[model samples]
Target: MSPTSDLLAAALAQSGFHPRLPQQRRLYEAAKAAIHQQRLGAGGKLPSSRDLARDLGMARNTVIAAFEQLAAEGYVVSSRGSGTYVADLQAHSASMRGVGATPQGRSTAPAATPSARLSRRGQELTSYAAGPQFEIQPFAPGDPDFSSFPFKLWQRLQNRVWREARNDLLDYGQSGGHLPLRQAITEYLRISRSVKVEVEQVMITAGTQQSLDLCAQLLADVGDTAWIEDPCYWGARRVFQARELKLRPITVDSDGIAIAAADLATKPRLIYVTPSHQYPTGAVMSLARRRELLDVAVRKDAWILEDDYDSEFRYTGRPLAALQGLDHDDRVLYMGTFSKVLYPGIKVGYLVVPPALIPAFRSALYDLQRPGQLTVQATLADFITLGHFTAHVRKIRQTYGARRELLRHMLAQKLPRSVTISREESGLHLVIELPDQVDDMALAQQAAMQGISVKALSTYYLKPPIRRGLLVGYAYCTPEQITDYGRLLGTIIAAEAAA
Candidate 1:
């Protein structure tokens, strides 16, 4: 569709437009929508009132009145003999200056000028998009069924927090986070993950990625070396890279993060591991490796950042206790988020560190960002304290467990026996290893064309010997959808394999 009419239809689709409305108001909304979407650019001529009415099936008089109202509001100008035209947006106000950005976030404004060049690091960061967009195509990894969250309960909790708000809540919160939320988290972690910590050690932040950023800022220097699991969560690795840390990708096996003698020789400044459940690969770190890692950190005087994301969604045997729970030297900083458990919108995550790091972390937090989202933190504290959070986690864990099984069953029935499947005890996704001859990148692109969004396993590697596979997430879709998706994936893989 042409941009103008297309945007108009989209805007109208989002509206509760009523014919009973005063004619002027209806026209005003239509004109404003068109302008806001930049479907009608500055000085772009709009259809005549009669033509607009006929096209939209509205009253001609109503369109005329709306046009008059828009003119009065400086949205459009009605020429003496010509049709109405959108006002010069840049001339109107700051709000109207860039209504024509394309879907990719590229500005559609012809008059817009380029800004100054970005810094070297900014340019480097933008050279390639580093992480998943979480686009909800079939088999996309790491996303949960966000729609299943109990919004009514959340709404009630939010109302309670706001209703009880005193004057102190109006100011910026303490940089470390809300104390009550920290206390709640401290209690929860001690019971659930077996991490022993006082409330003072819990530093609430936005989420896992922010937690990683904080670790980079507070613990390590720009050129310091960080040893991450080879096929690590790309998002966290990118955070460390953004802080200009040199990354060393250590191999991961069944025991998780294979720290070799050579790795010890590196004397890494920081070590990042997903010990509860290694990301993408789903390898749970063994107790032996966990102990070895803790010992290495103590010997090397290195900091360990434990990412416990998705550890709450285990469907198999009881999850292994967090690596931080095993640390005796106070070297590991444990970070966990409510994003996977409750929902991503909460933006609430906490860091449990050594008592000595608390002051530095709290100070660095304010330096990086001003204290914000106090109300959200407060509501989440109530949700956790009242046991709603645990209840929700239990319910969704069962649902995801069933979905995971359905996925496995379907893949087994439909796919070739040569497809090597690796299933682990927990996490949202599984690794499906493809044959060496099959180009994983090409397969991923082709699968995307067929409405799947799984990532090629080769893309996760930063060292020699890339692993050829696909990471398929089974947590979000229904069992029926999983079966259908499996059928489609099997067909796609069959065709790709033959070629």
Candidate 2:
């Protein structure tokens, strides 16, 4: 197959293209993924729009819509007699990449890899390539047990939604999202996370990554700096860096996201933090630090993107109220996801911005993503309203809590002297800090080869302290599986230590 067709096939398989998805969306996703990952290169000529649409079995208008969107986003350009081509992003936008390409029929030598043909920004993104891996093996961070999800109930809800599905429900929804789902989210946040927001302030997103991208795009400009906790969620870092924003990796302490004396001197346009339960390390940002961040945001006139990631699964004394709750001023942008609480396939996440910012947020989001599928949103709202969402969280919390304890016990018994267990108060994952001499990445690879999906603490660090360790997730595995994996991991560590 041609490279363009190959990319569509990849997207179809990777995204599990459902007939329910709009044809325009499928094309857009495939093209974006292809371009961003450099599977499609710069200056390459596109097949005639009509021919391509026919090949994909999509209506011609659907393909036109996709191309128009891509062009608007600076991904492609059309000429009067030369035909359509990928935008030479570098030639037009300095900070943008993946747009400009070598024209077809040109005699210039080809770049070695897709990455080489990309813009500087695009090449940087490939450096942190997190290839897809969803193995349910021991210690895989963020891999939840989907088998335990109430798929039957979900199917029934989906069935009910489709039976009553209205044509308008499938079209571009209110840029802010389906109203009922937003209301449900508002109510849930009020009681559960102490987050206060009206339905108008909450915007539905595809995932946390999309939310981050929106925050980066709308709040900050290219080359503007943003502060993220060092050893942070790699996904967030990727989004910010891809936008050509200068990322300042602030160090994290036991208190969480400690702003250093040096860091204070640098002006930031945006600040991204996981204040509820910090990723990888699992450290909860102290109330005092939360206040400090809020004050800093207010004083600096910077936007704070609080990724309340995995806060729902907190296995602690009533989960801490979200950092957004403490912000008196409108500087904080609160992000929450249904992926962790419910399941990733739900593809529903929401953002709460300040009231004054809602109109702009809605407009920008609609232009950027044109996101909808509200019939699914309605089903989610019904599920939340009927209490299944809460009940499932309660049940999963208890189950994951037990698994956490089991993993903790096993690690202490198996590798007590060799590793340090830090931050066990919240979230689905824990850190077992290893010796400085051990190479975490190599060890993790060995574990994976032995059928364990593990993450190295070193991989998360963009700045110093840069400790070596393993991140073991307990939410998905059974107690027995934890023990078995713990022993296997310990064995690997012991050998690494010896080496």
Candidate 3:
């Protein structure tokens, strides 16, 4: 048999081509697979129909039809007088191929690996760790108490929207999201978080993650400096990095991002801050720091991304207002998510852009991400307007507050005096700062083995970890589990310290 026929036969068997298929289709698919797999080289001559048919025990007509199909699909070329030849796809395939095909018309290179197929940026982006795991094990940070969400009411609202579903609701929704949801969000933000936003400026996103991605793409150019809080949210760091931005990690103090004369000289194009409630550390940005940051943004012509995630559950004094509310220069881009308050699977969040930038942001969000889930957006609008959202927040705040206190009490009572627990006045998780000798990452791993799901605080940092701590969550754990797992975690820490 000819080399082409041998490859075609092998590919047919290896590809699991069904024998029951029509001979023409089977031969066509087998030939195409061999060509795609580069077993058939560019410009290689195909065997005569009669010879291939006889070799494969197929009718000549079947082989002729298969060749014609391949030619029609540009997989093969015919010169009228000369026999058909495999199309020269080398130019188009160069990006996907290593070196080149061998003399036998087969690729000597290994399978196309990620390093070969993905772009430089894509390869670098994939190296970072993914977002939080959702196992909801004891002390898992970033997960709200799912058991307490009013699923029955949510189902009823979703069903109502579906039952009355109009063409607009079912179609590609407005890039700014469902109008009612935007209006609802505007009202809630103005009243609760003290954000200054109009309904027109609101653009719904998949969540804050998508919001970060949109900001990275729209606001800053490649290599532009972005000021990120050191020991920041890993997801935000990844998003900024994905856009190829230069990250300037600003150290965080009791008051949000500590600005230095050097940092002001750096003059970043974008500044990301979680001012209301800092992640892991839970330090609320003081009013003075908020104004100073705003001033810096104005002076540098920069944009501030204020991620107000999980600020609704404040147990202490009045929650500090969002940084966006303080921005007189319209340099702040406020981001909020229902994921932490409701559930992660809900996948609804909003970005409040400056009024003038709304059109560009809306168009970019639609063009790039095409935010949808209109039905869910509609349901969330109802949840907020009908007072369910307020009641739910109030109830969970009380519940999470009790849980937070119980866990704090347990840790204080059981752990060594050297182990300091900060008063995490707001948010779902708290950091347990350990002595410098303790390896927080190793402690987290040990806790994971015992079905605890805390995060090592050091991993969140952009610089070498200066602090050793474990981030333990309370919102997802029931009161009983807090007492039980809290003791277990304390015991583990004590043992590690003793060692």
Give the top-scoring candidate (TM-score): 3
- Scored against the true structure, residue 230 in model 2 reaches a CA lDDT of 88
lDDT of 3 at 153: 97
- Report how far residue 21 has shifted in candidate 1, in Å: 30
lDDT of 1 by residue, 1-499 (tens): 3355445555555657655666557657866867766767877777776667766667888778877777766666666665566765454223246554322333432332111134568767877655546468778987788877999999999998899966666666765888889999899889878997999999988998899998998888989999999888888878988999999999988789998878777978899999888876778888888999999899899999999998888777776688888888899999999888877777888888899998888888877767678888888888889989889989999999888888887777766766767778677887888888888888989888888888998888888645688889878887777999888887787666666
Off by over 4 Å in 1: 1-116, 130-134
Against the unseen true structure, what C-alpha lDDT does each candidate score?
0.80, 0.81, 0.85
Error of 1 at 482 (Å): 1.1
- Residue runs of model 3 more than 4 Å from their true location after superposition: 1-100, 105-115, 131-134
Model 1 / residue 194 / CA error / Å: 1.0
- On TM-score, the stronger of 2 and 3 is 3
For each candidate in turn, give its C-alpha RMSD to the true structure in angstroms: 8.7, 10.5, 7.3
| Native-to-model Cα distance after best TM-score fit, residue 120 in candidate 2, in Å | 3.8
lDDT of 2 by residue, 1-499 (tens): 4567656766766756655678797787778677767667777778777778777777889888988887767676665566667755445432233333446544322223333356676666776687776546777888666767988998898899899857878898856898888999999999989998988999999989999999999989999999999888988988988898899999887788999789989999999999887887878889899999999888888999999978888776787899988889988899998888777877889999999899988998899998987888988998998899989888888888888888777777657476788755778788888989888899999988988888899889887556788888878888888889877887777778777
Ranking by lDDT: 3, 2, 1
Per-model TM-score, in order, reads 0.76, 0.77, 0.80
Name the regions of candidate 2 deviating beyond 4 angstroms: 1-117, 134-136, 495-499
How does candidate 3 score on lDDT?
0.85
